[model samples]
Target chain A: MHADPKGVLTGVHFLDGDHACCEGTLAAGARFSAGYPITPSTEVVERFAWRIPTVGGIFIQMEDELAASIAIQGAVWGGAKAFTVTSGPGFSLMMEHIGYAAMTETPCVFVNVQRGGPSTGLPTLPAQADMMQARWGSHGDYAIIALCPNSPQECFDLTIQGFNLSEEFRVPVMMMLDECVGHMTEKVVIPEADQIEVTPRRYTKLPPEEFHLFEPREDLVPDMVKAGDGYRFHVTGLTHDERGYPSMNVETQDVQVRRLQDKLKPLANGRALCETENLDDAEVVVVSYGITSRVAQRAIQLARAQGIRAGKFRLISAWPFPEQRISDLAGRVKAFVVPEINLGQMVHEVARAAAGRAAVIPVSHAGGSVHNPDAILKAIVEAAR
Target chain B: MNQVTLEIPYEIPVDAHNPVEPFLRMDRMPHIWCPGCGIGTTVNCFTRALLDSKANLDKVAVVSGIGCTGRVAGYANLDSFHTTHGRALPFATGLKLANPELQVVVYSGDGDLFAIGGNHFIHAARRNMDLKVICVNNLTYAMTGGQTAPTTPDHVISATSPYGVFEPSFNLVALAEAAGASYVARWTTYHVKQLSRSMEEVLSKKGFCFIEVLSPCPTLYQRRNKMGDGLDAMKFYKQVSKIRHGAPTSECALTKSGEIVVGKFVDRDRPDYLELLRGQMTESLGDRYAEPEVSCSC
Candidate 1:
């Protein structure tokens, strides 16, 4: 732990969403950053490049997102906590490597401050549309851990958590931000360096001869060793056994895929893995994540003041969808209202978890604009009535 | 440094019993490539280049994307990464940047590099990242049962291009040069020695280096185009290739009869992206070595 020259959590300052994300990444013990300049997300990289080096870290403005992503992965392998920030178009380019990290179980972080897009729909605007894509964009059956930060502070705190989760699970963790949260400036306090808990990657204490790169421990997360650490372990994206050698055998494939899925699925069901707000005894619940969650929260508060029973379920971890929480809440709530920037994406998940217990209504808007609180409040009232 | 010298008077074989023997896994012999495949020869050239460059063996990381050429990483006795399809460059990029000391090489097929990963290829070249990319342009997707790839020439037939490919082929050397690759070259298996030399040059280049090897795919491409077996493809290459030491940039285009224009295309330094970034960072801080301002709010 480094000493805090600045008192812990004493600095209160206002910044845009991008600067907040940049600061959050630095505070989270990110010693290396590599990124390209893409609109809305560019500031995150610019700020990171300026801030990372001052903390005795390396910040690189890479040739593109591909290079940026690759550099961050390399830094992580070199035993440094690393990350890259990009928007929708760049995010699309990073999908393949993101899957590679997941398959290889390399610990790293990626922040996608999303813009509206199937392809460059809106560069300067916000969109929660990437929610579904973040979970299923890359080709394959693998689980990913993605967190949505509602405010700049959450962005700062969750960026650290993203690094921690990545190191703990030995997998790539995504900090899913939007143009809104990425660019939205708010007063945020930087924690003292000593106060912030930074988790370094776990290394094998065993002799180099006994080390296996992909050999899962009893906890299912393997202890990773870096390339030049004298431990020669083969790693591939192919389905492989504990030795990390390529194996196409059905049984081996099943086990490998199951391990990737299992590592993150347990957290989705457990209490500590997700966040829910004001759901007790509520008749109407709005299910949302990312920037839209903030809008839903405001609507929930407004609905409550207007004599309607409403609550909000803000998902911090979005990938292993809070299925159990939604399922449990379905029995008590009259209806689940899903407000997302994209049309009916998360609503499908809510509907699946609802399983006919409550009506799952989707209030969606496509590209640039966020789902307004009025639209959500109306849904809460309609669900309540 | 301690200097030790030994002298051996024995005459070594001209072809060296197998120049690839030093780096290859002979136990994994009789590779998975088809009888007429030129991939074996391409792999042979690559291994020879590695031996010639004397790159730090332990720090060498070979990252391969999906395709027949992608399997080269597995065959090499080094730190290998068989990554996802069309992602070898990005994976290699990560590997190189993470451990700047490591020599990173990306090997992928035409379908992997030019089609799905085309965007990454151009961007990587433009950034001039300190990594080497070797694209095996067999002109078709041989791995997926001979599908049409981006490099498949117009009027060439494949599984998906039964009526002849309508799309014009991408000239890889031109593409690399346009995208700002610090080093770009092209060669075929027929020019084995020249191809090997080009590989060495790319390996030695400080920034993004791209080499496209026009290999033959006898099972899919050769059989469909009636180009005969692997040996026949080599013979065709020998007769058609027009090798010039300093060929003009305009003359690097593909000619009829599949002639490969072999030579270095681009070799100039433009302070690599990472180096420029570091210089700027150092200049900005200027003696204030303490922790930089870190605030979540902008």
Candidate 2:
């Protein structure tokens, strides 16, 4: 489907990642947002608050992150594409609702502009520490889509993809941005409305009597209906049957929870977004995402300048981990040098996917700042040996 | 001793159907409420109000937080959401703002709405969002086995307060009024007709309207205390309750044994969140401000 022209800003402009993400939400046809202000991530909603009013939408500043997170789900069920933004502490507060969104299969977006944390570590600096939290912080065995954008342009581009994937899989999508990417200014060219593709919500056409709210189709995703549409559907956060009624038995739990993960199996390969280069001939691959991918690019170039054969595997969608592709490369590659702004978060996934088939080296950082390219270069050089 | 049959006072006719059955998920019944519980009674009043007010059942959505009363959303035959514990108000806020055409209602319990959800309640009321809030105040957390609640009166014995509660209790009607609700009222489940009428009244009200229904949690609350059963509590309400239509809310705080003040306290006009949003946006941005569309084309 084509993007709504009313929300698209068809022009070239120099913008930061936060502003670009806000524009992406507009072009993706999001008409409602609920947010609580937090450092580094606050600009995204600040821009949204100013931009959404003229674009014909509501940007509610909720009481706190708990309200902000669940409020967007309410908007989604009320028949609007919606999202919320937060940083580390706020993201921690939103974890329960993220689980709620997963349990109910409410399609929405949660943009986490990563800042340093265990608590309030660094408000103004960047970190990639939230990669694992985005996957497992919701306290359940549920699957979610998380996208890592490396630049302002990709921030605009991937955010739209985030919303689309969320609707397609009926799961919450996370647009993972670090403080560097969120704050750095860059040139972004926003295409015309028709050039952008958006996925409309899959509303059920079955009559009210026959429609069951949680009945999955062939793809294991149920078609959704809005509140006022007379379907009289019931949605809850409990383990429910296909009729959307609470059924608290082990059999129902097995059926319900399994489908939540099984539905996204298609994303592991066919829809996994990554930028790969030189992997066929290269023996050592530097795995990275977000801002680290840009830094790793220079290291890959420096390794190519020498005699060592080092490749680049930049992840665009970080979650679902692209394990199949990594496993395929693990057989041929000598070693995987994983560089990230955190203390070896995604690197563990790389090691697990490699499964002793090849050596895996983690170039970890404590993450008050981005990784130094030479540190990644040193890992690549050692792995090549 | 041989068992002697106690005479049954009333019987449901074999050919008759309940009037409120159409407004409920009959397949999900019989409900989970304990015997002599007042949550079901409040649901009956709500369904009656829906019928009497001629509300478009299709356009009404019920949102509830986690508690025994929170299960109201599950049995309600409308677009309903059984959301997370203590977050129903914000969820209902989003529902109402996203589709202004829908009538959003938040129905939950005392501990869910007043303790953990206290911030959301006060903020939602302060904004005057167009939501009908019905808090079934059972004075205890009945779902979790009779814990002391924010509304548990002083000196009341609860599972958590076996020594009798030493903390002060909240006056819910006073809280609602102070938080700037468009309409605020209090009633007990014993006042079924008046409760139904108040529910009907709020359906047409423009902004945030709160009705605190003092309900009997017979299994946990009444059993923990020396209060007999739901019937005895109903009789107690009938004996002590006095209706003062515009009484000062500050003086309506309930004691362990005191006159139960019940009436409408706050009813006045103020622009709701959407109205204020649109007005400010239109004033600042002029024609550039497009009023949000009520329904998505998709």
lDDT of 2 at B230: 91
Model 1, range A195-242, lDDT digits (tens) per residue?
677666778888766877788888788888776555545677888778
What's the TM-score of each model vs. the native?
0.84, 0.98
For every model in order, what is the iRMS?
6.9, 1.1
Model 1's lDDT to the true fold?
Answer: 0.78
Looking only at chain A, give the TM-score of model 2 against the true structure: 0.99
Candidate fnat values, all: 0.37, 0.76
Query: Candidate 2, residues A301-358: lDDT per residue as tens digits?
Result: 9999987899999999888789999999999999999999888899999999999999
Please list the C-alpha lDDT of all candidates, in the order they appear. Answer: 0.78, 0.93
Name the 10 consecutive residues with the lowest summed lDDT in model 1 chain A. Answer: A1-10
